[model samples]
Target: MAESSSTVGKRKCSQDRQVDEKPVPKKGRSLCSTGYGIAFTMHMCNFIVTAQCTVINITMVAMVNSTDHRFQFNDSTEGLSGDSSGGLNNARDTLPAGVPVYNWSPQIQGIIFSSLSYGFIPMLFLSGYLAGRVGTKRVVGVSLFATSLFTIFTPLVTELGLVFFIATRIAQSIVQGSVLGGQHALWEKWGPPHERSRLCSISLSGTILGTFAIILLDGMICQTLEWPFAFYILGGIGCVYCPLWFVLIYDDPISHPWISITEREYIISSLADQIHVSPCKQPLPIKAMLRSLPLWSVCVCGFTHQWLSITQIIYTPTYINSVFNINMRDNGFLSALPFLVAGVTGILGGQLADFLLTKNFRLVTVRKAATFLGNFPSSVLLVVLPYITPSYVTTMTFLILSCGLSSLCQSGIYINVLDIAPRHSSFLMGATRGFAFTAAILAPTVCGFLLNQDPELGWRNVFLLLFAINLSGLITYLIFGEAVIQDWAKERKLTRL
Candidate 1:
């Protein structure tokens, strides 16, 4: 059943009436409202938790050095051993056998680097459900605490053995996964329709920022103090911040004791049709979703976007190494540049999107526009990248441009779940995000295969293939992606999929 214009009009009118009934505060006061505060805290939570995902990768060198023998990464890195400043020796003095160097093969190191991915996926779907059933506050709150605790103890665990270290990383990732999708559920109650895009983008931008921070800083952190200090400093920040999250954030606006009446009324009125004040659980509408072309459009967008994103994130260093002949240290800074730009653009895109809405743009129009703006140009650039060889300035420019623009998708399909089904937004976010992350595994394998086929043409093939995949999503979403709540997604009966 399509939502008729009459129904749409009613929603608009309802929103208007509510605004009339309880006016939002002045612009200055609204900026400081509790909803924004919650979004900020969520951003901070994402910053630290997502950083934990990459801590192992960043500190691998220092960790290897923390073992019994001297760490000689290569003949070229020999200068690193005896530097007067914080080098291997400095770290060694600080952390005496803190991380035992088992005969961990390169394969084991690869697994440890990827162990967080293993744990992150499993908890995505479950966290979405538990956040709604038990409580978002409890789920997110405990997750931070656990993540911080694990991060803080990682050095101790590594001292025990490699197996223990890997296990702790995985366990830490398990809890860290919850905060990813769990936070979306809160938007149903806390975010007004016009405000949702910016709020969600603001919170999610933390992922990009956190990643950049870790990549940029943790290398120095490991070089100066030791690998353990990276985890310690980051984890300590999380530990201190978790209690504040509990104090400041609430599952819903109404439940927040400190919220001004004006803000609470504004949120409740804006979300009246979507929020389920009384909690209930029933079977998910799987059958309904099977018929949802719009849902599939979103899933495709999520997958294709994530596929390309994961590819760039993992292989950018390799690309720079081979194509630009940049040194390893320079590669780290250059590789992180895209995410930093993306984070900045995501926030700016968020504001621009909301501005469009305020100017009376249709929600679908804005979403589709954002999706197109985010994907089409980037895909074109990506497909053409292989043709432009050995131009460091040009290649780096386009690579950064391509990935930076992709962040606009955060305002598109990223928050579309809330638009379509606020009650099930968290679950949908998890399910779709989980579907997207499948690309994380597939991207590496596919890139490896393509590269193995022909060293030169292989890169071209990878680009063309990714472009084609991304194009399919762009086409699908433009045609079929929607922001309307499905009938099955609304208050439901006791029906199984």
Candidate 2:
């Protein structure tokens, strides 16, 4: 009887142990089996914010080309018989019906376009700091909402006079500037190591899509409805997107209520090698980051990149209209084509970059290759643009290729911050973007002065400036940029217990 009882107890103990040791498969279902929810929402957020950044491109073009404004000729010119002047005179005579131009001069227009950067530059650090402390979801959500509200009020602000209008735009710039840095912070928690490049690329591609959409729609809206409707429509879309962003996004997978156990586990495991710190409790390694040479290289490249990009965005329509004598409707379509090409190539470039990285190519080599391919070809094409005769189709083709090829940089310097310092990427991004906006402040003003001097000669000078700046960025980045994280970042000393 005693032996029988002992045997039964031992058997039960063995069964219990088996039950305890058995693995329980994660029961929670991912929002998407492949984790597309976070990716999709990030992409959407980028699209909305970038649209705000670029809507002015099309709106400004429409306003400048409107029929309500009077066209002035250079009083000092010897003859109005030059082919360029004659072409412009004929184009002005054929202005489309219902186009209403604001009588703002080129300089005023440049100020209006560049005003956003004034507000944009100062807020970069603040936004990143806030995102690090409070969490990106709240910071980004509020920023977008405020930006949209201001955008909706743009027409009223414009009616309030030039001073008030510029003030309002500056306010808008300050608000929207937060989005970029905030998103970078969020990616630290959200982007997986292997998929980081693709994710960042997809999100950034929103800028291209936004630019394309605004250009395609702005012209038609200005012609069919009124210029103010362009503001209303874009602002309304942003407003609608805000609620969705708040509902769908969480700062980290661990905190996301709706995330699956499986996906959460996957994210945590993938990011295990990266140092994680609660931003609220820890200080950023400001001294170390500032001392890092690679970071400064990124900033320098960003400065040059922004100078070229802002010039292209703000002036492309003007260039097309002034040089080729195209109408606003045609300008809209042609301007959008380059961004369309860019949008597609940006995705492809990102995918290819990730694939190469996975193949064990040297990180520095890949980055330089991508940057060279994107910047050098685009610069060559831009230099050729001034030499090309004024065939609308040919000019459009060159512009499209130049812009499209530039998308390859998306795979290079654009996401390099995330590579070198995943934990501090948001702050680094802010630093880099601050430099970019500073360049933005200068580029348009310079272009304005140049274009105002002589449209033909000034444009040639502008293209030449672009070529020089683009090449400089490529050279600097190749010489100084690094993909590996610095030892200071790896120390993880900034985190508090």
Candidate 3:
């Protein structure tokens, strides 16, 4: 993962020269009708935050008991007033205590639902292309408004069969992807170049923070009211956000009257030399993009790291309850620690990566260091976990630290997208996420299938599987995971054969 001297020289000149350049005023770019674009971006950011929260809250509750498999919305009804006559009551009967929640049916359903989040990537990949043909502001505003509507209706689909549940989740997923993809494209139009990472981190961090809010609030609601109420409350909150987006978001800094002149110049000058591609009117070379080794490496890296993460986030409560005999409510509180830690670590990790770059460290060196710090140790810990015989609190402390370290991979994977394919960052992100999410769909089912094979031994096997995949990723990083482009893309152009 070392950067070549030539790459370093090129980057130094490009970055340093840009750092010292005079600002370019964006006087001609209209600022008359951009309030909605600015407001929409912020609004979309907030919606993602809420969705992430809802995901974690519902997942934790769903897997807690085997026989009385209550969905969150269902649980809320029972908690709020003991009126569980609908699908909630029916699903509850199916999930009585002592029944293992890791059955085939729920496993399949979990895969489909979780895939919604990952599916957002493809939606985003196309959005840039779509926005270019249409208008950027129009695409974002309409999509955000539609997405919020779906988020609002998610809880209302309180049916017993799997169709309603999966359909609602799929609908939510499509909308979520639209908002994120649209927002990213829109932000690229407006965000300052040097500050892109920091700004992107801020927007992404909202997701993590929103998740933290959901976990704590949902936990309280689950304890005091019910799980369905958690969704109801989230849906209600989401409704309020849609209007705000319509009121505030803008497509580019220059377009927004509210943005200061200094801010607009700084933004335009930052990316003056770089291509500001409008959406593709021509079809994207998705196939060509997939064939590139550098891009595929990004996909494998994300797949490995995300698999480990999604598994932990979705199943940690199950692990705590089964392995240490902790109660559901206590597990919810303790389980939230890792996500919060990850949120903090995500910010720290991004800052740390930036610091390394500022010190003139090789891009490969910085990214590889972060990748190793995140994945390698977590792999080792998964192996060692089986043998730990500590108290419940001590054991979960290990779990918390294990997940926190994984945030390094999250930061590394994201930054690496920009480093390797700056021109196609959005497309690459989409392609990588599409491939990696197959793992997301698989993690739960694999865990379930394995556990079902031998309840006593399957859990241990799951850890081993996680360890193996993570190690495979570590080796990939060691061998082929460079952050600097190293003329890989250039070679593709020259050797077009």
Candidate 4:
């Protein structure tokens, strides 16, 4: 996508000059902020939503093979600790007595894993447009509740057939696309300019924590009851969360019933002039956005980051199990541990970015530093992971460090969307995420193909590709990314029909 000038509205050059003439103000803080409450709700929403997406990763191992079909692996393949496809045999034995299995190849499994994003991508822009008009609170509530119900029924869909299961997954994700962009809209109304990173990152970190908690829970649930129970349990939790959301969430601080006077004043005052566009009415500057290299540059990182992230979220459990013969329960613990670190670092990176800005660091400087520090080490570590195969302590260390560091790029790339265009934050989020999420579709299929082509070197090839992508992404952002709002992104007075 490229930005070019279009005649949606004439720019108010004089008004823009007057606004810029006002003295820069000091940042404000309040003792009791309602924004934090909304942020936390979005955080929990992230957790449950992401958990649903990743639950299949753990359960797929059980779906594909049973102890009855021991040699799922080719004879030349050196996997399963030398026990005739050891991972599947143990996974089968670990499950409760009656679960059925399918004879799906790695390529077929890749399509299944990548299926959700296929639906999610197209719905992102449409849902975001709807949320801006119908209200995020309603859109998000319906979406969260529906996806939860779908998750609860995932196993039943599986019984229907492979195509049905994939369809169900896609349908579930289309609902989730609403929740993904809704929070960015919330931030435009509630977040103070100075607190943007901290607030947004706090909510976003829930995605990492959700992935961690679900993987851990999936193993235990699979061990105790069965694979289907993991979906039922998490889905049940999400259903319960839905009611709390409706009671608590509002579009903006002014409309929130529980917001204290002082906090409301603080938030409204702090964001008084920064957010100018009305997403409900403003016609996006499509040509201008198309021309904005900075926006697209940040988007590049979004793409590359998702490439690595989707790979980790979808395949980590299988990788650990297949390569090291880790049992289901232990595999869960190992796969989840890295994400826990990532969650912490995500918040820390946000705080760090905010601190640098508060202390007068150039916005581009902070962005470049975070982007480089975050991606470089992680890319190197991912590539190293394949080289140092099966080294238990070292492998775990690298994985954790890589995940933890890579999270900082969220602060760099994502928040920049709001930085340059708060007026279009939700729509931009949907657009950029739509672009980024294509990686989610590609990563699994590509990984599946690589693994299928050369079982022994497939994992190596995957990591090497991620490293190249990450490096190129960082270089792009360093060269073109900017923090200040672009002229094309300026608020324009739109004529309503």
Provide C-alpha RMSD values for all models, in order.
Answer: 6.9, 9.1, 8.9, 5.3
Candidate 4, which segments miss by more than 4 Å at Cα?
A: 1-32, 66-89, 277-280, 492-497
Q: Assess candidate 2 and give its TM-score to the true structure.
A: 0.86
What C-alpha lDDT values do all the predictions have?
0.72, 0.72, 0.57, 0.78
**Candidate 1: residue 152 lDDT (0-100):** 91
- Of the candidates numbered 2 and 3, which has the greater TM-score value? 2
For candidate 3, lDDT tens digit of each residue in 254-333?
A: 66768767657656666554434333223355566656666666678778887787677667665654554333455567
lDDT of the structure predicted as candidate 2:
0.72
Pairwise TM-score winner, candidates 1 and 4 = 4
Winning candidate number (TM-score): 4
Best by lDDT: 4
lDDT of 4 by residue, 30-117 (tens): 4246787787888899999999988888877767753112222235433443234444546656677786567787888889989988
Model 2 misplaced regions, further than 4 Å: 1-35, 65-100, 277-282, 492-497
The window of 10 residues in a row where model 2 has the poorest summed lDDT is 13-22
Candidate 2 per-residue C-alpha lDDT over 126-203 given as tens digits, one digit per residue, 9 for 90 to 100:
787678668888988999899989988998888778899899989988988888766777777777656666777777
* By TM-score: ranked, best first: 4, 2, 1, 3
Error of 3 at 64 (Å): 7.7
Model 3 lowest lDDT segment of ten: 488-497
What TM-score would each prediction reach against the true structure? Answer: 0.81, 0.86, 0.76, 0.90
